[model samples]
Target chain A: MLTLKQDHSTLIVLSVLADGPSYGYAISKAIAAKSDGHFKLTASGMYPLLTKLEKQGLVTTSWEEVKAEGADPDATGRRRKWYTLSPKGHKQLAKHIEANRQMQALLDAFVAPAVNDQNAHA
Target chain B: MKHTHGNTPKPKPPTSRDGIETWLDVLTSMLSLPSSQRTQVRDELEDHLRSRVDDLLVLGKSEAEAIRTAISELGETAQLARHISSASRTPKSFRRFAMNATFFVLAGSVLTASVSMMIPTHTNTTLPGATEAIVVETAEVTEPIRHRFNHEREPVVDVLQSIATAYGLSFRFSDGVRKSPFGKTILDTQLNTFKGEYTLKEAIDAFQARMYMTYGETVLAMTENELILMTLEEHKRMQIEIQAYQIPSWAESDDDQRNYGFSIEQLISTKHDLEYTTIQPVNGSLVVAAPPEVHAEIISMAAQLEAIGKSMQAQKTQQRIEQHAQMTRRIDRLRAEYEAAKSVYFAEREKANEFSNRIDELRSRRLFVRSNDELSKEQQEALQTQINNLGEQSKQQEITTDEAKARFERLQSILIDAESELILSDINDALPIEGMNDSKDEMRTVSIMGTANMRSGIYQLPEAGKLTLARFLMAADVQDPNGKVLLQRGGVSEPIGTVGDISSGTIDSIVLLPDDQVVITAAD
Candidate 1:
């Protein structure tokens, strides 16, 4: 699998949280699953990125209790910190995606002649 | 993992497992954020690692292999920490910059203070006169002239002449103006101009300011017919009047007074602007007229002289105070030594008096005997005259104890020899007793066989007494109570001498007592 550029790490984290509220592990798993294992987000890399995004007000977090199945009713169960995409995060993600699309269009234009030349040689 | 019933302990969650804890430790150490954020990052990383490990275990991997795989998928600790550290340090870098800037400002302030302290207070400049002229000219030349010129680095003199011609004014230089130092300075200066309208005075003033010169009216006249361009020294005249009381003491005498006025003029002459000066010293006052700039310099010189005088006076006072303190200390030391010497002198005098009194008592009881048959009548008379002379000598004042002791010893020996001659005569023909009373006289005596101890190698008698025959005989072999012989008269087996000659004109009697004591009996 090919690794994505480090600058795009923020965009990737924000995009994963755009679906709904998610914890750090879920966010990393979603990014890897959405990119089809091409851009695997590591736990170490994903958490600081989530913290940076939260500090920038692009995401908000709260602790949620996730209990095991058939556990005692009196027990509080395990606590997982959940991250949610903010309004600012939604706007930033849209702008970043639009910029990525524009860059891709420019790359395609630049690569199309090269591909045509290679096809003519073939 | 298998779970047991009732009493068995609950298994730990995947997040708290050993492999997850190890990975979190490495990540936490690498992250250089604030403690709260660092712990948050560690907790999030632990949760994510647990989820990955559980997912791998569900895919049929063993627990150990699943934990290892989950950890391997994360990026290198150093790279991840760097990214997080850079993100966290954005605000910190700004604070760091502010701190560095504040340090530089404080350091600059300290450096400026140190440099200002090292620099001298006095400043030499022609700015005061030039600045005054500039203000005046700038106000007068508010309506600019329509003169336009284009020149590429032309001589300042030509530029000034052109500006003068344009303004319909004549420019003139003094006789030695071009050859003087000021002329050399003006000649070296150059001016460049483009198309512009500028007043002649304003242009000249601007050019002069660069060379530290002032453009103003000459002392002789202020006319439009000839425009004069003189150095700053040729500008204005100033007069100073000094009162009679303010004159220094050295200016009192006629010759010194003349030299004093000359020296003031000489002080003003040191400057380049000494072409015109008038110093008149009248009986009660002094008046000076010179360039305005020279007035300031003279005032400064006067103040400096006053400061030097005050400093010298203060130094003299300090030296006098130190000398007085030193003299006072010396006088105190000498007084203490004199007091100590006086006490010692009085104590020695008192001891000498005690010895004198004892000698006088001993001489009173002593008797001298002589045989007239052993000597002719004339010889006897001569001996009697000598004894009388010695008695008279002993009566005089200022006699020391040692002198009195020698006289007593002489009298005793003379009496002893005379008595020996008398004893050899026919059974003693009337022993003449001169000092003895008509009635029986009392005598105080002490045995020298055992009495007091020796003091400074001389035995002191136990009792005060006159030297009778019994006392003299007992003192022949003197000793202390301890049986230590203090003085043995003439040595062992020596014949005991008589208490002789009390008849030689009543010579002072000699006395012997215990413990080396001796007495001289003087006649009343």
Candidate 2:
């Protein structure tokens, strides 16, 4: 499994919210499910990253009352904190994706030579 | 329904719930965010943990097992606290520097505007000696001379004289220029060292800036004297026209007019080279030849005096308005009091009239009772007289309601007593007079008896012609007199069973007269 970079987490969070508004648990679940259990997101890492993104005006948060499917009408099921990508967050995510594509191309050249050396030894 | 009765165990409180709460409390206390922000963070974390526990519970784990797994997935509290604290810390010093710079710029703008308003603008008015035709022919210097000298605590005029001596120029003061008030003020000024190297014109400009004086080069042609130093005000004279109303009115006396004129002359003489001259002979208008600065000063003084006059007129008008307001307030108060008193008097008069009408009604009832067949003519006449007197007293306006009530009570008592007396007189008339015919002797024994009880006997005297009373002896037992008995002639009642016992030789005789009258005689 590849270790996610510090700025990669913020980009991933923003990209997930760019689709629609999502809460902390839903955003973490989506990242894990999309990466096929390879990238595990923790609450400790995601909450502070969300707080920093909110302070930098890259994302915004709001509290929503979400009731469970079978909950009683008067019951308060849960308080979910929802985050959405700001216009500034959309611009920053696009810039980060473009940079990652160039970095991937640069790494591809080095990886091709290393694989050929392994193939010769085999 | 099946009924099962047995000892049921109480449900235990959730241990993992307590553990999550304790962890949140510790984490929030460790973070340095504001309390409101810290509460938001705690709520968010708790919600996340509960959601995880709910997901685990759907997998058929016990509540305790689900809570433990949720907390372990959330990660350690200390690491989360450190990350949140670092993220939320503000850069205080940078914000403070920006605030201070903003304040300094605002203050500097205000100070610059104020200083620009205070400095006066300079005007290019030609001086008297600025014409080259009036310039003195002294030794012309091909190059400018620069002097570098320092003098500590020297008088300003002495410093200027030393500068003139170094330039080989003779300097003298114009007439009255040195002795003027402005000259006296500048002469007393002690200047510190003004050390610099400058040309002659530059040095003189600096010296004039400090002393507020200028050099007169035309004195060589005009006064045939050396270079003259006079105040800047003496060099520029202008004629100012004054209207008649601008001159303050003088008092009635001629001495007052002369004193005022002398004061104007003295003020002009002390401050400027000018004289007060009348412009129009009849209207009290005048013209003064003075420098523009001195003319401005005089105009300012006139404005101050006019302002004082207007202020005094306004004060007088205000005092009159205040006095009128005070009188109006007093009149309003008195009018209100009179209205209140009038209402009270009307109420009292209404009550008195009510009582008077009641008394009149009661008197009419009494008159009807007196007119009945039971009352005798004399008793009716007496009762009518009493009612008339009460009516006369009650008709007077000053008679209060209580006095009328008291008079009604008295009339009632008098009528009751008169009725009783008339009934008693009727009973007395029915009594027998049997022993009166047997008593013809001057010393005859007589027996007096009556059905009504009496304690004393009443007799009429023969010669003196008056009724007299005689007490009954102790042996004479009379019953209680329940009814009244009237004794005629004296019209008095005496108890029955009273008789005369003669024991002295002075013969006292008793005679029974006709018509039931008994007469007693005493020897003279």
Candidate 3:
């Protein structure tokens, strides 16, 4: 599996949250599923990115208690933090997509010659 | 989707299984964040771990194996902690570059300089003066410059000029020496005593020594990046300075004030020509008049003396504190000994009282038997033997009581001295409590052989103490103990006793004390 760099990982996470609000585990699953098992974002990478995004005001977070079955109603259960993309985050994601597209076009200019040579040889 | 929460939710408490909990504990301990943030991060990670573990469990993995797989997916705990810490502290900008030693990238504004040498003359005429403007160009060399000069036969003047050119130095000769010189003096000298890697200072010193041996009246003076060969008499005419150095407070007494000047004079005279220097005691300070270089040496010497004074004061204070602590430890040891002896004394006294009571009772019984005339003679004789046996036991008890009393009195006397003791008191019976743990703190080797479950080799006890057979077996992780255990002590060939199952109650109670060897073999 390919490990994503910080900027790419941030762009992916922000793109995932653009659809709707989601928690850390669900976002990780979405990244893996969306990339078809080719990409993995572990909990270590997931929560810190979420925290940095929250600090930057690109994402806002809220907590919900996830009580286990047959657990005490009065007892506080495990907390699940949900991160939602802000309006600023939507703009940031748009900028990232445009930047990524420009980078790919510039890289393809260099790579196309090698491909054409391989095809000619074949 | 977000659910409404009235208050902040508490973190998930640790469960009994604790596999995931232990991982979180280690991960959180490495995070140098605020407690609230650490807790939030821990809870968030714990939730992620639980969700992953559940997913793995659904795919037919055991709870323990699922936890392990989930943890492995998170990568190394330390690396994860580092990432989280770096992220939370603030996003950082990183730059990376590489350079080979042969090539270095200089900044655009920096001008590189290369140095080239020019040797013009063999005579010491037109030497560079104090106001001479020397425009030097320095080149950056990655490696150290090594000098090697092997001359079978050469003029000293030519060799000196070569050294001056190679090391970028200029030379001057005093007027007296210039006038008295004659004939081309050919000498053989090996100036590279340090092979090839000698520093500039060592090379100059080596050449100076050779000059001194050849011309005993002349000395080489090196200062301010220049070398001067002059007779010892002419060196005193150079630049001189007079400075007043206030002696440190500890050496301000009359005798020390008188002697401090001589000490400084003695120190600098060995290395430099101190013929023009004079030291006089003036109002608790040394008024010294010497050359500028000698004055620099004197200032350095004064600083060193001040440091020595402070160090001596510190040492005295440290010695006092150590002496006080030694006295305190001795007192504590004496107190423990006194308490032990007191206990022993009381126990012996109680035993002696019991013996006395039993003897008295036996005497009363004998008197009653004598009063009852119908009693048989054999029964009376048996009663008499029992009374005699009780009397002998009482005598032994008295001896033990005396010994216990003596020990108690010895400790009491030491304790009395400890009350007035400014120093450590010498107490005879200063045994530690339990009287065995002192040796137990030392490491000792315990050899094991012919073991069915455990490896047959010398296993060192983590400590030197009375280790029981059961505890040793438990520590060694020996299982299926259906064997006979034998112990040997003091290098004895004969086995002491055959111990039964180490897991059982009665036989496992046997102690495997310090320096003992045990052999466990299967019952055939």
TM-score, predicted candidate 3 vs. hidden true structure: 0.32
TM-score for all predictions?
0.30, 0.30, 0.32
The regions of model 2 sitting more than 4 angstroms off are: A1-3, A68-72, A75-77, B1-18, B93-524
Between candidates 1 and 3, the one scoring higher on lDDT is: 3
Residues B149-261, model 1: lDDT tens digits: 66558876676577556656566665445546656666666766433555454444444443332222221111223345543234332122121213454467777767777
C-alpha DockQ for predicted model 2: 0.07
lDDT of 2 by residue, B1-524 (tens): 11122221221222222435644654664454667877888878777766665665455444545655666666555556655655554443112111111111110121011111111222222111233211111111124446775767898667766665554445666555676655565567787775677554455555645543232321111111123454333333212323222244433355555555566656656775564333222223233443333444454555566569667756755664465456446545655655555555555567767656866776776678766767778876766776676566556643554454555455555544543333232222211111111112243222334433332343222221111222111112233322222222233333322133221112232222223332222222
DockQ of each: 0.05, 0.07, 0.10
lDDT of each: 0.48, 0.49, 0.61
True contacts kept of 3: 0.24
Give the distance in Å from residue B7's predicted Cα in candidate 2 to where it truly belongs.
Answer: 43
> How does residue A118 of candidate 3 score in lDDT?
98
Give me candidate 2's TM-score against the actual structure: 0.30
DockQ of 3: 0.10
